[model samples]
Target: MSTITPHKLGLHKILKHIPLNAIFDAPAKARLAKAVNIADLRLCAKARAHKMVFDYLDAGADDEISLRRGKDAYSQLEMHYHVLSGLKPPIDMRTKVFGCDVDIPFFGCPTAGNRMFHWEGETAAAKAAEHHGSLYGLSSLATTGIAEIGEIHKGPKVFQLYVWKDRELVKEVLAKAKEGGFNALALTVDFTWYGNRERDIRNDFSIPPKYSVAQVIEAIRKPAWTYDFLSHDPYTYACINTDVPADSLAAFVNSQIAPEFDWQDAEWLLGEWNGPAAVKGVVRPDDAVKAVETGFSTMWVSNHGARQLETSPATIDVLPSIREAVGPDVEIIMDGGVQRGTDIAKALALGADSVGVGKPYLYGLAAGGTEGVIKALDILKVELDRAMGLLGVGSVDDLKKRGPGLIKRRPASVRDYPDRYAYERGYGGGVI
Candidate 1:
């Protein structure tokens, strides 16, 4: 059994009390409905967290134009539906991911310092995934160690690894994960340098965020997250310390370990883990091609939740070409900007074998705990089933066909539009 699962009487019990009437009445539930209604989980999160955290989750490099475009691109494309499609009274949301069969096409992406949001941290996320028959991914920076979550949960698990200056540290963490029966080792490649998050700057965010008197009062309003947080001592948070060498939290983040990385280092990591090593943070077609050539079992595409690298390309915009470049043999997994089941469907339609979701589940963790996390996943399952039935597709195969037609090269007429039309039709529509 994996160590992490939702605690019913602890934090999740309150979730059972959330009245359905409150789905629209309660502020949190209402926002959850908004997220589920639009099939975008990010909406649920943006509504609740401190503006600073929201910006941290939502921002991207330079102007964030690509980030906006990434979601908007999905909006511009239309979904095709077949009426009276054979709708299973209830749909099957489970599928095979990596080498394990999860109940859904989703996994909890490893998120660090979860204690900042709730006391359970990795345990809540991992347990929720286990309950749903999914995989729980643990961050190298997580508050709850892999052992904790792995001990409590029975399901597929993944460890997100960051290469450090100390090779022994990397081996040590890997050994722990292996001992815990972790199934996959995902190496995050894009965080070679963290992104310029302006909101985090305003919040003065850190691994262990400092609290002001005002912050304490603000926390009092959300008793659910606060109580659990207080349940763990040390007042502030940060439970994961994998015996890696680092001085302070700042040093741990900035100078303590490796922030320098490249493809060669990644290939070496693949050899080191000597297991199912997936290259996370891949967003370019060429990079995806080389990832396979480099001998990775999967191309885990992401934009670091748009958290790192202010200049990274849109993970979604680059997915199609990468899928084409690598062909069907390679596994194309995606993350970033996925809030709804429809988002999951869209990615699958565009060649993603599956997706990894962040933030929204954290919202669930903050609002209710394990039950909240499970609610978040269950929300996605319902949304996905409805989306598939509406699209008139019967199964995953039907959904895969929906992929090719979803995106296409701009037609010359539409591409040129008024400018090119002006050139070709100038004699007929305007002065030569």
Candidate 2:
């Protein structure tokens, strides 16, 4: 090696330099400024939101095993490309979900109490969904009422129905959904009882959020979020209570959710809607098969984002078996652990008619309101288009036809890592 030269160092006379400029100049603004992906948005969202709020949004039920497994399963999957397979430019991401033609292969899954995340909340997400040419599921517990979202977003919309203790309340909400021109109704069937979301239990998070001393302290740290909270109409469950008091979410669930809810209730709701309807939380293959037999037009294969059961199977891992169970006729839409465009493609390849994203859009909403949501949608769209091109497919149909061959599943291997990182072989590895 040559000796290091330290003396007589001077700037080169003709050195070339990259001409740098502001990404957003004066008189212009950047929304989602540093976020490049949904994961980045998650970080931004965490930074913008209080710790309690972030935990409520990020944490899953019990040990969060399902949540980790869901994400890990996606990581283990590898997609193969058909090199130079005569695929052309302008890859199509458009398809029909629940009889509505969409520009993308994904939709925003319904999440309750949007204003709790941000003041713009459901309306912003609805608008972003429309802007990207997709559907937005408005929650029964949405901060904005059905009529308002319906009036604003002209794109396809779905209303998530939770059977309540009050029959009249359920009927009233369904009628409003129909009047509001909702394209379909997704009947949520998983929450016979609330999951043990320990984050909420520990944080003492409540709907029509009760700000505890800890929360108030957190609010002071996140002053921007606090300002928005104060400036806007005080947070309330716009759909259910204008200002009703409840002991806790678990108590409210016990009081409101119909414990006796069964297939008969599902049938009644289906008949009441008398339109395209989906069973929202079918996890087992038999249940998926039963859903079709029960006259449901679609089966939303989900586990409530792993918020219901910690031990439940990852949605993607169970998707293929469910597809085989339901056969080719019934539509299957999946949600949970979708954070990338490749994740969307993987779901489609595995036989999902369409995918639903909840936390990704929520992250976007927490990061930058409507623009952030739009950014999240746009990012996924771009990633999907690029992934399609790389995978040597042009249309959604082509993707479905070749998906099984192009995608293969395998368990994550210890040998994949460096030897130092690899602890032991076989059974010994488990202990490691």
Candidate 3:
């Protein structure tokens, strides 16, 4: 081997080239640039947000078995890569979701109280989604109003709706969405009542956050987040609170959510919107069929991000059957535990018309605001393009057409053998 020289090694010179002032001037961009994956973004978010805030975004329902399993289920299936298939660079990721053209197969899932995660909030995330040529969903409980997000994101946008105890309130929000030029309505049917999220209890986390001495101490540790939170407009449920005022999120859920909401209410809501509509929180094959019969244009295969149910099946595990139940014509938007671009491929290959991601984008929003959200979308888009190229597919349509042939479920190990029956039943190794 030739002897190494100081000039050839150049290890010391590497540090000199790093633009230190640029990094200092734009710390958020610097921090986001370092994240290579959704997991890295989560770590960045954890570092920036207070424990209570971060946990709220990160944690799931009661044991969080479903939450952990959602990501795990993606690993259970293996892709069969094709070699020598004549596929070229720049794989086409374009697809129509929620009646709007999108450049990618995945869209942002509607999540609540974005302001709690960052001051830039829903608008920042929406803007990023717009930039990526993907759809952004605004939650019924979003801190940003419908008009605001509509104004910012000119691309396709969907507004999530919860049928409230007050019918007029429901109609009012829908009217605003129409006026605001929202593209679709996603009626979330999972949260009849809030699931037990123990982390929130342990931390005493609430909307309009109650600052105890311990919380104050924790907030002080994250000075950047604290300064941003304090400097911004006070956080509220900007859409619905104008008509129905409640002191706390728990109270709002208890008093506002119509526990008696049924399929009739969903049908009624569909009639009212009279546009592209989706029934979110659908997982069961039977429920998927019912959603189609109920006049929904799409069935959003979700378990509320595993937040509303402790042991619900991972969305991916149930996607194939749901697709079969709804047939090829009905659009299926699968959401939950989509942390990788490979996951997006798996969902499409298995039969999802499109995919929706909640935690991944939220993690990005918490990490670096608008740029962070854009970074998260960029990471997924690049991974998807590379994954498709390697898998010998040139377009999302081609991936979907190949379908089950491109992927195979791994044989159940001894640990997973006992739950094989449940998995076959699409229950994610647990009984319904």
Candidate 4:
């Protein structure tokens, strides 16, 4: 029989309180005040949001293997902290991305349909980003219009574009982005087709969400969310032109994708914008290289938050290779599974110019509106500052200069090697 340790007893006691204190009826501000970290914010959001809405924000493609892996990859890294290096107060976390200075190395990602989560929607997120002086990304499928977001967020903004079957519509949107004072363009390339999001399917989730009997019960359970949703303007794809009609909103959105889009087409779009642009979903080294050649000023290394592909490698795991492929000059923004300040530091140390976050801020938005979002950003900023101080670095550039020397992959656990013979033979029993 195995012996029980004091640490184990302590852990068990902590676990017991989790369920006992699972309160969801508190006011949004009160609940948000207790959230000291992104994970805490996530819990608050989960308690406040409807089941379908929470799942839509939280779940990923099919088995969610990529989502799990993306987070696992970050957790597997061990930082080589430097003690007694005499780092001064107020660590410099500021960095420039897309030719705009940001107070932190983190930025918001372009997530669609924010209104489903909170009535304030993208405007709340934009307000939080502006407050933090972090870049904000506006999705093509945003619940708020492009011009409105641009007018609201005075800080740097990137307009994420999805190529549509209608070229004229695409041009019109791009023109609108330019007029709205968006600093740059991010052409998202990985979403040629929607992934099989089983959670959404199971919940019967849709744009302008339709509630079934079970979902109605769920809405009643989350009375605060339901009340706010009902009292607000009816949810619609506020960014898309209303004239385009289809059998269902989902069908219309899905049918808008130009499946035959290619590098030539991407180049054409780049030419059309003729300004600072990033290719937002390049994961492969070869693809990263091609993005630069095709005139993209930055390569956004992402797997669409692990929402598009099931088994794709974590964005952090691919950052170094993409950086090497694109050389030192081309900017790289690492996205997906960034839950901590350490994750941001690790990405910068691995060669990312900046990192983009999607679910964290969205979780914050759901938990406490703009206040929650600001808290989420503040948590990351504080964490990153602490990490930089502990790492004996003073600025973002110093962390990047130290590079792989400051962090390394943790060795695989023995349990990961069920086939010991294969491991000894150097043939496939290790973690990928």
Superior candidate under lDDT, 2 versus 3? 3
Whichever of 1 and 3 has more TM-score, that candidate is 3
Tens-digit lDDT string for candidate 4 (215-280): 779988887776666555555565677444211456766889887999999999998999999998
lDDT per model vs. reference: 0.66, 0.78, 0.82, 0.82
RMSD of 4: 11.5
Question: Candidate 2 residues 1-432, lDDT tens each?
Answer: 632211113111111131111221211114257567777677667667777777788888898888777766776778988898787678888898998999888989999877777779999999998898898899987778888898778988889988788988888888888888899999888887888889877887754345667877887777656555554554455666756432244666677898698888788878878999999998899988878888899999999989987789889989999999988878889998888899899999998999999988998887778887898898888899888889999998789878999888655553132222111221111210
By the TM-score metric, which is better: model 2 or model 4?
4
Poorly placed runs, candidate 4 (over 4 Å) = 1-26, 242-249, 413-432
> In every candidate, how many clashes are there?
18, 0, 0, 0
Ranking by lDDT: 3, 4, 2, 1
Candidate 1 structure quality by residue, lDDT tens digits, 135-247: 78888887676767778777888788875777777777788888888888898887666567666666665433345555556445554444443344332212235454211
Q: Which stretches of candidate 1 lie over 4 Å from their true place?
A: 1-66, 207-209, 220-224, 235-250, 257-259, 406-432
What TM-score do all the candidates reach, one by one? 0.79, 0.87, 0.89, 0.88
Error of 4 at 113 (Å): 0.6
- Candidate 2 accuracy as lDDT: 0.78
User: Which pairs, if any, clash in model 2?
Assistant: none
